[model samples]
Target: MVTVSLPTPVQPEFDTTIHRRKTRPVPVGTVTIGGGHPVVVQSMINEDTLDVDGSVAGIRRLHEIGCEIVRVTVPSMAHAKALADIKQKLESTYQRVPLVADVHHNGMKIALEVAKHVDKVRINPGLYVFEKPDAQREGYSDQEFADIGDKIRETLEPLVVSLRDQGKSMRIGVNHGSLSERMLFTYGDTPEGMVQSALEFIKICESLDFRNLVVSMKASRVPVMLAAYRLMVKRMDELGMDYPLHLGVTEAGDGEYGRIKSTAGIATLLADGIGDTIRVSLTEAPEKEIPVCYSILQALGLRKTMVEYVACPSCGRTLFNLEDVLHEVREATKHLTGLDIAVMGCIVNGPGEMADADYGYVGKQAGYIALYRGREEIKRVPEADGVQELINLIKADGRWVDP
Candidate 1:
């Protein structure tokens, strides 16, 4: 008889402290937001609402550049109709990318109309009420303010319920410029006020049993934006509601300054594993936002398997045109994925620094380059063919090369 042996149970490998916050998953079409899914990056198309063709064209452009979610403003009934047609075309062409309708007010009517078309709705709760500072200054009573708040809540109630019944997702996007005057007065015009405003809306959604929701508290000021999100996270934890947080610094300027501001604020939250989606709002074309968002996520290690280029800054000891070489390599390999390449000025520290990269090229004597893969010298290539040689090696490894 053969001896029988019992199998030993497998043991846990290692202990890690990096636990992602538990969140309720909300789906916008096929893309799942929150609940441990990879954080999504989204952008809004800045096309005229009346120009349906232009808007559709913009959507196509955004899709080509990897915008997972696109938001277009539906301000009027005509815009809503345009959205319906646009949605039909988008569904047929780009089925995977989801469209979100941005509705400011008239929630009851707009929500009912747009709910049939778009995958998600972004409501600015602040825009629900029409604030008249002069009227309030005329000795408005506390009861009147309370009544206004109640009315605003009542307006949103049926709309929220209708959308929930229709099984659509909603985002309560609160902006600093549009806060209710009453809340600003109650909590003061500070970061705490922003948090309170967001919480109030979130509680309203929860009261309606609409848990498939995302929340954003955006302020143009960096300090205000940072403080508000930190406070909002604490408040959400206290409430025991795990809705996914959408992170962005709203109206973050146009060029390098805007990129820096957005990256700084978003990087802080992502490093702490707090945000579930990111939007790098810039004043430039919406297509530009996609790459910036990806770059931010890539730098944070939240995104795995992308071509990462590390080039050293040229110093006095540099032997060649390191700047020009680095630029050429970066531009040529911008779209390649799942590889790490480095361009260094010198072989002494260059090869050693890029020891873990899949392939690298270090500058040596005039018009010569030292190619490497994980500290081992692969071959020598001319300076002109250095980048091409690296590309060929990467392709030989069966990684996709962008044409």
Candidate 2:
């Protein structure tokens, strides 16, 4: 029989990396969003803006713990003017942190003032040039719609020009609960309305040669938020607009479910490679949100800020207390960054499953554990000596550092 050497069987290559959507870079102080930079973490400080010292402390607290950008509410002219003091104190007492001011409800003048003090100014499209709804009116006529559009352009131009001339950025943050009556009537209470509202403001900004903009479409409900953002991406792509998107799930309540809800929306978009900056809007302290943000990014393999622990659940084959051992390994290595360590319960799957880890502690025989350095069994030691030996092995490899 002629040996048929069927063209050597080839395994298909699969890429496991997240390919983020391409977008233009927008600067917020020292940090840059999009243009292939690392995804940013941000949050809002609930301290009253007029309380200069408290606001400064709040901002410093968040920034010290990896909050890349911090936002404050500018609800009145006093709050708007107070930002100057806030910015000054932050620079003198701490470093100058990137600041964003949230302006709402006919905030043309307020936005222009806050634009001077903050690195970025965020405006709600529906409320920036607010108009009271007519209780008995029918749908807006074509001319009526155009007239309102003109009013929006007239109101939005000054702030856009100020930010453009100063080289500052703007975020067109549209909330589901705050949609304008015009948008609600024209496009209904839906994601399409949110996308359209953003597009209208974007066009005005574009007309003035101002493109340093970030956009957010946020809702309390996950499905509505997801749909708005996905639709926004589609519309932007079709229109050749490449502004970076800021992601969040607004008003997610406190505790376990809050984190889950925020993660469900934020991580889903991030995994799809859509978001540039993110804020987890939980009802807890702003400090509490930063950890959740980093966890999501780390879990996706986007950023490695802490040690990665890979452990197998204990079963009949397990020789030792897997949970306790894993906890010990983690406590010992938690301070070390950029390392992946594995704690396996049995030899049957330990070596094979942990082949990708930097180091592993595996259950071997009765009262013994095998230490591995990336698939190579370095040594076998008593179960009691396993943790320290793993540390010794890491030291030998020059990967250990004092905590």
Candidate 3:
């Protein structure tokens, strides 16, 4: 199930070389992730799971905007029980999008009770097993480590059995910020420490013959996040395990900064063919995070879920109110997925620069604009009428679909 492969070949439209690491396929509800499935785009709800109505609304909104998977936090038994009602509500109305339960602190306990309700249960390896930092213990001896493994097996077997029986999957998610005190004391908060933390739990599941699993390594810092995933892959190979990876950059700020920061961290691993499911963690409305997830996947040629935009950087030679017109063009064309549209500031390089676009809008003179069908200049129109003219041009070419 774990095979190293050449990058999946792309059609001529995209120039890319990213062969995803081949792992066993894990089904989360109806969606298939990893094992050559198109990189899945998912988002986590900010709403608490116990607030069923609010969480359901968030999940519905995300699904409407092309989010393939939605996750909710389950911090207590009440939260775990509420997932059943939430699942039923969404299934009864909205499409039965795959739902995930993100359980921290005593996740095994939460996961056990919620196994029958959600598609997948995500447990942070860092917080799953907590030993007080001050507990008196030296470097674990072989006998002590063996006893610990047996204890883990005894604790995890019931949950593992329940998940396998219910046809649910598990994500052994690891976070840099919450590495266990044992891990911190032993490995000093390094990537190795993170991987070891996940492997501790993963080995238990494998021992119990459970196979539906996903893994994640997340950090706010890009370098640390990227290094952790790369090292994770190397270790998985050595152990001959093939669990799919969920990629993310935790607490990636908000607005443009979040988008850029997430893009750098997620895309770096994706370009190397290392991620299967990804969430762009922005400090904004959860629905707003969906577009960035798809955009990152689109840019990597892993998947295309929205419009392709080409906007030239404005300069001294630019004409017209570039800001107002650019916004207009976007408002008109944002729904045009797979069609490349160019909005340029001036003729100095607009026509040549937009050669890849199917259609373009370029500044000609003050209060005037030039349009293009690729590189050829098509027509001239007044600046005030340019937005409408460009829409008309695209519609005439049969490239426009009513949004």
Candidate 4:
């Protein structure tokens, strides 16, 4: 039976079940994702991988920002050949961040060459070396569909064998925008079609006893992305396959819109305990995507990278400058990570809302502030003294570490 090699056990520092999914772990280089490991963060380089200097610099910046797994596009044979240099420069000078070679259309040959260099390989199986079949235009006879299946088995078996022998991992990444003609004709570009597109190759890998796999079903639309992932997990369960999932919403455009769209889709499944690793597909710079990935993980309580602040929208009930105080407190305490700080406008719902907070700053009177640790009131201090008091409270409680 194919099984996972789980990571060494670590004590749970917080309640992780809120977004924790149970799956067998897959190792990509030194990082172990799934099977109760931390939700790993990943991002891809926007540069040409064949431009070794530019790609290496981009990977260096991404590594500095906490990107655990970095993927570089290998669109053709030249890029595949570039992988050796990219891997060498990264290992010799920079940190050994796991490199994932992302390939399309000509994935079989490219993946074979790139796999020998990178730690993991990701291919959109829906279009990997697949051509639009005559069935799409002329309609399929049963034999034509069978022929397509045979082609997939032939093309993919060699790559799977190569990956298995190298002990490298592979991602059967399926995007809703790129389903094969065979899938669109049969399932009509729906989530079912996307899931079926992935399952076709997944079955092939399992048949060869290849189990170092991760699966993804990505889409630009939130509804489709969410539905496809939920359905994929159900399908995996039925097949007794516990491969970790890589979650993302593709072509999620730039700026605040990109962050919001990506977060909503990624966080939805995470809250239900479905995803194991994530990439925020913003059209922004690759390094920018890393923080967004970490923010989503931290917000879901799956990973905590920095201080978490909770604040209220100011109203007539508020006695202080709600926005300003919140901002000032954040500026002062942002350096302290894994700490929950609440800044509320007034006492009405302030204490109740921050019931679980490590420290709180809530408006108590027209110009005074109430401080708290848990639900217990620490003191009532003047408005001018609130920020300093909160800092001192953290220090007194021994939760403050020099930043």
Please identify which of the two predictions, 3 or 4, would achieve the higher TM-score against the true structure. 4
Candidate 3 Cα misplacement greater than 4 A, ranges: 1-15, 364-368
Residue 292, candidate 2: Cα error in Å is 0.9
Model 2: lowest-lDDT 10 consecutive positions: 4-13
TM per prediction: 0.90, 0.96, 0.89, 0.91
Compared with the true structure, model 3 gives a TM-score of 0.89
- For 1-403, candidate 2 gives per-residue lDDT tens digits of 8997778878888788998999999999999999989999999999999999999999999999899999999999999999999999999999989999999988889988999999999999989989898999778999999999999999999999999999999999999999999999999999999999999999999999999999999999999999999999999999999999999999999999999999999999999999999999988899999999999999998889899889998899999999999999988888888998999999999999998999999998989999999989989999999999989999998989999
For lDDT, the strongest prediction is 2
Order of models, best TM-score first? 2, 4, 1, 3
What's model 4's lDDT at 397?
Answer: 88
Q: Candidate 1's residue-wise lDDT over 37-128, tens digit each?
A: 98898999999857877888898898787788888888877787788778777667655468898887655677667777888888887775
- Give the alpha-carbon lDDT of every model: 0.81, 0.95, 0.86, 0.89
Clashing pairs in 2: none
lDDT, candidate 1, equals 0.81
Number of the predicted model whose TM-score against the real structure is largest? 2
User: Model 1 compared with the native: what TM-score?
Assistant: 0.90
lDDT (Cα, tens digit) per residue for candidate 4, span 99-211: 89888885788888988999899989777867755643955668877898999899999999999999999999999998888888888989999999999899999999999
lDDT of 2 at 69: 98
Q: How well does candidate 2 match the true structure in TM-score terms?
A: 0.96
